[model samples]
Target: MRIGIFGTGGMADALGAHWARAGHELLVSGRSAENAAALANRLGAATGTWPEVAAAADVLLLALPAGAVLDVLAASGPLTGKVLVDCTNDPALTGAPVASRIASASPGAHVVKAFNLAPTDIWQLTPPAWEGRPLSVPLCGDDPAALAAVGTLVRDIGATPVAGGGLDRAALLEATAAFVIGLWFAGEDAQAILAPVG
Candidate 1:
């Protein structure tokens, strides 16, 4: 599978490494062409402009910051019929879910919300395993095919993909990220808040 990554940041590097190792074709692009070229070289992938990446990929990973998503997509031309995987989390979360907003911005693109809850460090773990179990990633999207594609990518990094329902529920995931991030900063155990399964 050809994957286009839209950032050269930590998340892009971490996830891009996994996908590249999993034998997926990668085109990495960012605001800085030089950084994108460097990252692409490190990952054994290709570097391109944002428009080139968008045109070359079947799946597009928006690994950019939350605030930049709208502006970046707006400048990237049409996204009709594209599978757009959104990994952004807005700490403020003042508006609609990022995935929904991306859907509105791109119109016909299939937007899937994923990989926001986990920190970039976790993705660096080979297989992303905790104890003896693979990490379970929660995903929300309206399109089944798009969800399946993203799910496969999730599994490619040795994580389990759990459905978090449709795109309408993506805000919940974003809210959870904000709350969990707060707990992490406060040096609290976020797992203590959840009860054991019955």
Candidate 2:
């Protein structure tokens, strides 16, 4: 897979490393060319302009902040028929899911919402395991092929991918993230809030 990551931040570095290790070709681009080059070097991937990366990749990871997603995509030229993976989360909880917004902004692209629940530190984990089990990631997307592609990437990072329904349900995932993040920030054990079902 030719993966284009549109940021040089922690999430980009962590996920890009895993995909690179999985033998996927990578092109990293962002607002800062120097930072992108540095991250590309660290991941053993290539660095290119946003437009070039967008055009060259089979799959594009919008590893940017929530506010920057639309602007960056607009600047990256047409995304028609692209598999766009949205990993952004809105801390403000202001509106719809970022994936839905991205889908609206790029109607021709297949947008998949994923990798937003975990922190960058968790993604840095080689297997992202917890309690002797691999972490389960829930993904929401309308396109079956796009979902399957991202599912492969999830397993590439040694995590389990769970179906999270269609694109319409992506807002629920965002709300879940906001709630869990609040609990985490409040020094509460979010897992304890829910018990296992028999």
Candidate 3:
């Protein structure tokens, strides 16, 4: 699979490394050509302009800031048929999901909301786990093939993919991230809130 990373930040470094190690071809691009090149070098991937990367990738990971995502997408040219995995979160708790916005911006792209729940360090884990259990990632997307593609990427990074309903439900996942991440910032065990149901 050819994966394009649209950011040069920690999220890109963490996840891109896994995909590269998993033998998927990667092309990284961002606002900063130098940073993008550096990240690409570190991951043994290639660097290109945003539009070039957009054109070349089978899957594109939006590891960019939530505020800048739409603008960047608009500049990336056509994204028809691309599996766009949105890993960005709007801390403002905006009513609409970023994935939905991306879908709106790129008419034919398959947008999947995923890999936004955890921190970069967690994703850096060989297989993020708690005790003896592998971490379960919740995925929200309308297209089956898109979800399946993102699911394979999630597993490549050592996480299980949990079906989180369709694109309409993605806002719930974003809200949950805001809430849980807030709890984490308060130095609380966010996972403690989710006791197993009988």
Candidate 4:
């Protein structure tokens, strides 16, 4: 898919890199030309300003923070019928506020919430722990095609995709993040924690 990402952080870069590796036409956009170009160069894809990014992509990814998404979406103008992949979390998440916050502003696109539970390091260090025993990643979205496209990409990374149901199920995904964090703080092994959630 033609993926355009709106953020310039580590998370965005990691996912962008994967998409680039998968041979997708990836666009990295934001206010920072240098940052965007740097990431784009690393990914060996294209880089541009926000407007250019929005105009030339099939799938748009909001790698921004939860609270930032609504305002960005509003300013970004109508994205109706577009496919949006959100990796945002609620700031009020004392124990994972709610993953539904990923769809703030009630996005018009096929919004999917995946890749939020784990650290961006996972993508850089390893897409999944092992090639065969890939990590189980939970996802929730409304469109079957969008979900399946994402499912294929998730599997391409050697990870298991757990269809957590419709878009509203984002709340449950958030709860899982909280649970994962709790387990980690309580000293549970990382690989063993998210395995059963599938």
Candidate 5:
């Protein structure tokens, strides 16, 4: 897969590094050309402008800040039929779900909400695991093909993909992220809140 990383932050570095190791071609671009080039060099990938990367890649990862998503997506060229993986989380974002918002802004792009539940350090783990179990990633998207593509990427990083229903449920995932992240910061075991059902 040809993956386009639309940021230079920690999420971009961690995820991009894994995908690069998995033999995917990567194009990295960010607000800072120098930063993008640096990240690209680190991942052994290429650097390009947002529009150029958007045009050239099969799948695009929006590892950018939630506040910058719409503006950056708008600036990127038309994303018709592209698989767009949204990993942004913002507790303050009201109104629509971030992935839904991205879908609306891109028109024809297939948007999948994923990689938002955990911290960047977790993703840095080679196939994140706990208690000898592979970490399960939840994904929300409307298109089957798009979901499958993102699921493959999730597996590429050595995690299991859990079907999280459609795009309408994305806000639920976002809310869960906010809740669990808050718990983590509070030094609580967020996982303990949910027990295995009989």
Candidate 6:
């Protein structure tokens, strides 16, 4: 897959490593060319400006904070045919409906909501984390074809993909991230907090 990742932050770098390991050609972008190139070099993926990266990818990962996502997408131009993956959630985000808006903007493209429920380390699990085989990643998207494509991406990163159904289900997905962050902020251990789910 010709993948492009925006932000080049921890989550972006982590996910990019998984793709690099899987032999995908990855292009990473960030606000700072130095940081982006550094991360790209560290992960053995290609590095370029954000617009260049966005234009070249078959799949694009929005690895920015929720507050900045909309502007970033708009600045990147009409992502009409790209597979847009959003891994962001801000408790303070306002007036923007991402999944539908992104889909509408992209026309024939598919928008998927994912990777926001857990920390970056979730992808670094030594023994893959699904219930039966490894850890299961729950994703929600309105488009089935897009969801399936995301499932493939999630599976590529050594996770079991759990389809949480329509894009509206992101309400649950967003709230889940809040709860997880709360638990982590409360100083709970992974085993203790994830006990029920894990």
- Provide the lowest-lDDT 10-residue window in model 6: 124-133
Tell me each candidate's TM-score: 0.97, 0.97, 0.97, 0.83, 0.96, 0.86
Candidate 3 residues lying further than 4 Å off, grouped into runs, are none
Model 1 bad stretches (over 4 Å): none
lDDT, each prediction: 0.92, 0.92, 0.92, 0.73, 0.93, 0.77
Compose the digit string of candidate 1's lDDT tens values, residues 104-169.
Answer: 899989999999988888889998875566889998999999999999999999999999999999
Return whichever of 3 and 6 wins on TM-score: 3
lDDT tens readout by residue for model 2, 98-193? 888899999889999999988899899988875666889999999999999999999999999999999898898899999999999999988788
Query: Candidate 1: deviation at residue 185, Å?
Result: 0.5
Candidate 4 structure, TM-score to reference: 0.83
* Residue-wise C-alpha lDDT for candidate 5, range 1-198, written one tens digit per residue: 999999999999999999999999999999999999999999999999999999999999999989898999989979999999999998765878788889889988999999998889888888777766778999999999999999999999999999999988999999998899889989999989999889
Q: Which candidate, 2 or 6, has the higher lDDT?
A: 2
Q: By the lDDT metric, which is better: model 4 or model 6? A: 6
Residue-level lDDT of model 3, residues 1-198, one tens digit each, is: 999999999999999999999999999999999999899999999999889999999999999999999999989999999999999999887657788888899999999999888888888888777776788999999899999999999899888999999988889889889999999999999989998979
Worst 10 residues of 2 by lDDT: 126-135
lDDT of 4 by residue, 1-198 (tens): 888888888888877777777788888886567887887888887887666777687778788876666666666656766677777765346543333543555455678888778767776645665444557778899899878877876776667889889988887777667677677768887557435554
Please give the range of 10 consecutive residues that has the lowest summed lDDT in model 4. 95-104
Pairs in steric clash, model 1? none
By summed lDDT, the worst window of 10 consecutive residues in model 3 runs over 125-134
- Each model's backbone clash number: 0, 0, 0, 1, 0, 4
Once model 4 is optimally superposed onto the true structure by TM-score, how far is the C-alpha of residue 44 displaced, in angstroms? 1.5
